[model samples]
Target: MARRALLTDRERELIEGGGDTDDELRYQAVSRVRRKIQEELTEDIDILRENHPDLYAELREVVCESN
Candidate 1:
């Protein structure tokens, strides 16, 4: 079993709230939120690889990483 990344309504609120103030603060907050989302996406990919090895291999061959 793998750890799941679950984003709740409260978590969404917190992420959104981080952008309410000054531009610098909002930029930092948005960056943090983006990092968190990327982490979660990676975790999800890991779990898929573990549970569906063949599919994962196929996906890896077909998908390209973005900048």
Candidate 2:
């Protein structure tokens, strides 16, 4: 099977385990989701990332985290 591009549980755990502040953790999570969304959802992530923060976040949370 093709490796799923969506963030995996292990990836999330490792990222969470890292000694980072809340802001840093949130950044990492969003960044990871954005990258995965770009891979599977759209190439023009800049548009969404810049113009639609709420949509961008929802997509990342609903789609990227539920693999």
Candidate 3:
């Protein structure tokens, strides 16, 4: 079965300016995506970091340490 996306295509478009072609479009998309992720996840992340440090660290290490 196909997995569902956490964010919808409309959400992506709203965040990404609808696939605009410009020199700065990639940069804009990256900035917008990063900012949106931080905005949406920061609160829950903070709570998890404080209350469930192990799980938080595991997730953080997986996402951050992979690269």
TM-score of each: 0.37, 0.33, 0.48
Report the candidate with higher lDDT, 1 versus 3.
3
Q: Which stretches of candidate 1 lie over 4 Å from their true place?
A: 1-20, 52-67
Lowest summed lDDT across 10 adjacent residues in model 1 is found at: 2-11
Give all candidate RMSDs, comma-separated: 7.2, 9.3, 5.0
lDDT of 2 by residue, 1-67 (tens): 5475456765566556655536666677778777777675675455678899987887779767996
In candidate 2, what residue range of length 10 has the lowest lDDT sum?
Answer: 12-21
> How accurate locally, in lDDT, is each candidate?
0.65, 0.68, 0.68
Question: Of 2 and 3, which scores higher on TM-score?
Answer: 3
> Residues 1-67, candidate 1, lDDT per residue (tens digit)?
6443344454445556654546665566667668776887678679889999887877677666533
With a 3 Å backbone cut-off (N, CA, C), the pairs that clash in candidate 3 are: none
